[model samples]
Target chain A: MTLGQQILQQLINGISLGSVYALIALGYTMVYGIIRLINFAHGEVFMIGAFVGYFIITLFKLPFILALIFAMIFCALLGIFMERLAYKPLRDAPRIAALMTAVGLSIFFQNLMVYLKWIGASPKAFPRVIEITRFEVIENVYLTSDKILTLGVALVLMLALQYVVHKTKMGKAMRAVSQDKDAAQLMGINVDSTISFTFALGSALAAAGGILYAVSYGKIIYNMGTMPGLKAFVSAVLGGIGSIPGAVAGGMLLGITENAVSAAGMSMLRDAVAFAILILILLIKPTGIFGKNTREKV
Target chain B: MKFRSLIKMGVVFAVGFVLHLLIKVGFINGYYDHILTKICMFIIAAVSLNLINGICGQFSIGHAGFMAVGAYTAAIFTKNPDLFIPAAIAGMPRFFIALAIGGSVAAFVGFLVGLPTLRLRGDYLAITTLGFGEIIRVLLLNWKFVGGASGYFGIKPYANFLSVYILAVITVVVLSNFIASSYGRACIAIREDEVAAETMGINTTKYKIIAFVLAAFFAGIAGGIYAHLMQAIMPRDFSFLVSIDILLMVVLGGLGSTSGSIVAAIFLTIVTESLRRFQSLRVIIYSLVLIFIMIFRPQGLLGNQEFSTPMLKEKIRLLFNRTKSGKGHTSTEGTE
Candidate 1:
């Protein structure tokens, strides 16, 4: 590929990957906005969703589309379960304790898979359900239909999320809780339920990301989620932790930067680029591109 | 507490030393002996990490990264011992000086990593530290000049149980002293509330940096010991998973309690080793244990409390006094 074409391909991959990052980051950012805590296990939730997709589609031999929906719904329940079981009792506890629990949860899910599978961190092939023969867009540039499908799903999901946040009753309640939990409660909005709903919403998005990821990658592995999860977190933080738009921007930027830098044969600079963005943002504009600079208060 | 406590601890340690000698010379083979040494090494790691996560209230997920720096530093020295030891013997006055320089090298790297990353708090700090851990591993993987992805190996194996225990003792002493001082109180203050601590003039940044560097220092020492013990380590060995294991030790021990960390370290090491028969089921169990603890016993095993009663303390005092007076050595007393 020519230099220009190479750069274009890299950009395409970045944006495609960034779409998933944005999807996952939305989950993180929404929950963080409400509770002011980073759910470290959010990554694992995505991982679980991917595996769920695998089991449903490959093991049960369900149609691919049906498996995707099942993954979303199943993971939504899990998101609700996590909040009720792990997070509800600790609503008043210190953020550190809850954060640790999230970390533990991440470990638990990863190990849960490990225990189920005899091999640890070993890659298992996902059935090649999606055929990518030729969906080329330009001269000597062949784009898979998987990429287009992922992009479409990601866009639709994000739009649906925005609608839920702004144009729906539950979304309005979530907004209220995020803005002021006590006041939200006084207004007769069920704060607990709203948070749960938010979790479910976020998780559904993560499930979509996971299925697409599994489909695009054509393989599933235990440790795969960790880096991508962390990268999405960086995206969430970079774009502004609580801001929806910021998460998208951050995810896209991270995905693009990582791809571009690696494509340039500077693969090692990937993390540095992410962290440098985080540090620079923290120092210069801690709120992020779309995030408002927030101060901690009870 | 009052300087007399050190004397009491010394006598107990001396007795423990004799008991250890008996065990070492007794029915165990080199394999279990190796495990004992590993337990000691992890004890140091767990205890030192407690300084930051338990005492200072900063969640650092990069313990293994600090260890990587130490391991690499010690490995370099061991790999080229002839080059440095003789130069050190000439440049310094004693063999101890070269060893001191080696430990110092590990400690200094701790300071470097701790300087910037320690500024973060809570999950943010955890994320930064986790990133640092991965950065170290990736960088080491890319460092093909030093064997890269294959790992830097073949360091001289000068470490054994005795050296590991001695270094662990030193680490415990240094950390305990540091914790008992006003600086330690500053760290506790951060744990309590950063705003309040800052308002009260604790200089949160200063104490945070200190706690992190100190944690890093001992982690480095433990790493140095580990490098010599395994005689082979890849970048994969120091992955974030290793960091999580260290975090488990600190958390399981009851964060902030030195005795808790030590107990947790030994417990986790033994349990983890024993569970190795289960293969991949081991981590699943560990993760489940962590979850169970978080759900049911968030304060951990012993928590911030001691395993023994106040009455046992008086009994121990009398026993120690008797041992000092030559009534026979008070034996079988362990902190756990």
Candidate 2:
């Protein structure tokens, strides 16, 4: 393929990968928006979701859509339990304390899975759930069915999230709580439940992202969530941590940049490039692309 | 004050001599000797990290990056004979010089990194430091001169339990002294409240950078010892996880407490070493302990208090009194 065509092809690949990151980034953005705590365990939640989906397909002989749905439900419950058990008690604690708890929970989950022998340290091949077909988009550029499906599912979920956050009463409650917890509580909004719901929603999206990631990569492993989770977090921070649309944009931008670097035959620098962009954005624009700078008050 | 410090130095030397004799007699054994060396290295790293994250309240998670810089710089210096230093100044003296060079370079890099990133606060500062760390690791991975991804090898083994123990003792003494100084109080002030500290005419940024540079210097020394101990070094040796491990030591020891960092480092290192047979269970227990500690006692095991005989006696008395009274009793030891 010519350079332009190759670039186009890489763009297509990047978008598919970017959508997965967008899905995971949504969870991080949403959680940070509400609690102002970086849920480090959110990555492990993604890893568990992949395992759940894999089990649903391989053990129960379920269809791909059913596995995805079940994984979402399971992870939604897990997210709620995780919040109630680990985070709710520390609502009034220092931010650093909560962050440490999240780190602890992340380590706990990763190791727990290994100890239980649910997933060994080695990578497992994800059973093929979708038939992939290539279609020529241009003279030299082509698209795969898997890529199309990934994009389709991600777009639908994002739109659904947008609708929930914008139009639904629960979303309104979430917005109120995030805006001012005391005021919302005084206004009769159930702040605790809203936070739990936010965790559930974010975790559900991460679950879908996990399954899609496993499907794309064709394998699942115990510690698979660390890098992707980190990148998606970088995406969340890049797009402005609290903004939904920003997460989408950041994920896409990160994915594209990473792909472009790889296409230049420097695949090893992919992780480095993501971090470089993060540091630059943090230094130059601490508030990120869509973030509104708020002055600190005593 | 000078006499007291001299006595302290004499005590340190006595301890080092005893340990060295034990190692020589094979009573410590090679395995335990290795573990002791590691404990010393971790104490240095943890104490340095506490200076930045605990005393200064900077929340830096990229400490391992500075450690890497020191390790690679020291390794390169000792491995390449072409660098200027008289061959007559070989052995222990030369190794100490290499460590000093490594530490100085790390401190300079710390100045460079801290100047720009220290302006941000809390989690933003954290992410930025983490970014710098990953960038450093990536750069090292791509640099073929340092052996790239495979790692550099065949450095002289200059580090031993005695040297490392002496350095570790010096690290604690110097840092504790620094913390007791006026500059140390300024760091504590910054940690407590940056705006209030600034209002009090403290140069918050300058103090922050100073703490950061000092912390990096000690971490570099620790890294130099680590490189010499292992006789080989890899980029992956100083990854984000290593930073987290050091952070764990700081937190578990109780932030802002040098004695706490030392105690935590020794305790966790021994625990980890003993549980090396059950890796997954070890990590699980560690996580559980961390979570429970955060939930029940976010101040950490020492809770910003130093380990002392009087404090120990007070704690024991409090425990007995609480049991006798059958009511809750809170100790106000470290509150002041």
Best by lDDT: 2
Instruction: Please give the lDDT score at residue B206 for candidate 1.
Output: 85
- DockQ per candidate, 2 decimals: 0.50, 0.53
Question: What's the lDDT of the predicted structure labeled candidate 1?
Answer: 0.79
User: Please, what is the TM-score per model?
Assistant: 0.90, 0.93
Q: Report every candidate's CA lDDT.
A: 0.79, 0.88
Off by over 4 Å in 1: A117-121, A133-142, A268-272, B1-3, B23-28, B82-117, B120-122, B306-336
Which structure among the candidates has the greatest TM-score? 2
The digit string of per-residue lDDT tens for model 2 on A21-140 reads 999999999999998988888889999999999999999999999999999999999999999999999998877678878878888888888888767788899999989888999988
- Compared with the true structure, model 1 gives a TM-score of 0.90
Q: Which ten residues in a row are the worst by lDDT in model 1 chain A?
A: A278-287
User: Looking at candidate 2, what is the lDDT of residue B45?
Assistant: 96
Q: Give the lowest summed-lDDT range of ten residues in model 2 chain A.
A: A274-283
Badly placed stretches (over 4 Å) of model 2 are B1-6, B84-89, B108-116, B131-150, B309-336
- Could you tell me the interface RMSD of model 2? 2.3
Model 2 error, position B201 (Å): 3.7
lDDT of 1 by residue, A169-241 (tens): 9989999999999999999999999999989988888988998998889888876777777788889988988
